[model samples]
Structure formats: structure tokens, C-alpha cells
Target: MKAPPHFIRNNEEWIIWLLEAEFSGSATPHALSSRTGISLDTIHDNFLYMERVGLLSIERDPDKRYPEEIARVNLTENSLRVYDELKIRPDPGDLF
Candidate 1:
């Protein structure tokens, strides 16, 4: 599906749209950073902000070894609804 005009207004929204379209239930800030070339700090901050705005949820990764702190991010139901409304989908040409 094609994303509607103004569906993604900025990099942060693009990241959220990407999460909703491609990652959904299994995403991490580090992984998103790797995928989108956005900085980890920016990803983390956006995750937190999105969570606050009820667009996504952040949870501690339970499978992490030792004391490393990592988060698993998931799009909330509201975010899924927004994605559906926007007809957002990953661009095959951009997948890597």
C-alpha cells in the first residue's frame, strides 16, 4: 500500500511508520537505528516519546545476557490503526 501525502511529516514519524509497517511486535532502538541510519539516541528518545503519546510501548528485553540494558519496542494498537489508515507499507525497493 502507498502512504498518503503528509502521512510521515518527519524522521520521527517515519520511524514510527516503519515500526508499524515492518517491525510491529519485534523492534529495538538499536535495530531501528541500524535499519534507518538514525542515531541510537534519537531512536531511543523517539521511542520514549511515542510511548508517552500512546503510539508504542517499550519493554525490557528479557533474553539479554548479563547486565546489558536493551529495550524491545512495539507499536501500540493505536499506531496500527494509524498505519492502516495511512495505507503504509514497506517499499520493496528500499528493503535491505
Candidate 2:
């Protein structure tokens, strides 16, 4: 399986994508930020970029009650292919 684009295959974004995939599209930007030590704004910005690149889908809450209740992020079909590739042969540094 071929890898994703360089930007999506990088550590930070890749980890976020992995986590979101693992959560079955229920992963929020705040959760990603907390887990990855990335700022909420940075996570949100990356989500938007990933969506634009066809790598992710971010569904904003229609209610939009709170700032933190933005939406859930999930990997797209194309992104899932990359996820499978990563699973088959993960980076050495990713082995924890």
C-alpha cells in the first residue's frame, strides 16, 4: 500500500488521524490536542486542511452549544487506505 501525502504521513497529523480512526469518527479536536500535546487551534486548523485534502471529514455539531463542542473528526476512505498501510508496516519510532 502506498503512503499518503507527505503532510498527512507526518508524525503529528498521522497520529491524530490514527486516533480519530480508532475512535470511529467520534474523536474531537480537543481530545486530539490533549492526547498529542498540540494546541486546540492547531488541531482544528489541521482538521480543516485534512478535510480540504480529502483525507478527513469533520462534522460540526448543528447545535453548536459550546466552543469545545465543535465536531468529530474521521478519516476518509482515501485516508483509511493510508491507515491500513501504516498498520501493516508502521514506522519504527511508532512502535511503543
lDDT of each: 0.68, 0.65
Kindly report which residue pairs in candidate 2 clash with one another: none
Q: Candidate 1: what lDDT?
A: 0.68
Give me the runs in candidate 2 sitting further than 4 Å from their true place.
1-13, 62-69, 90-96
List TM-score per model, in order: 0.67, 0.65
User: What TM-score does candidate 2 get on C-alpha atoms?
Assistant: 0.65
What local lDDT score does residue 82 receive in model 1, on the 0 to 100 scale? 73
lDDT of 1 at 28: 70
- What's model 2's lDDT at 81? 71
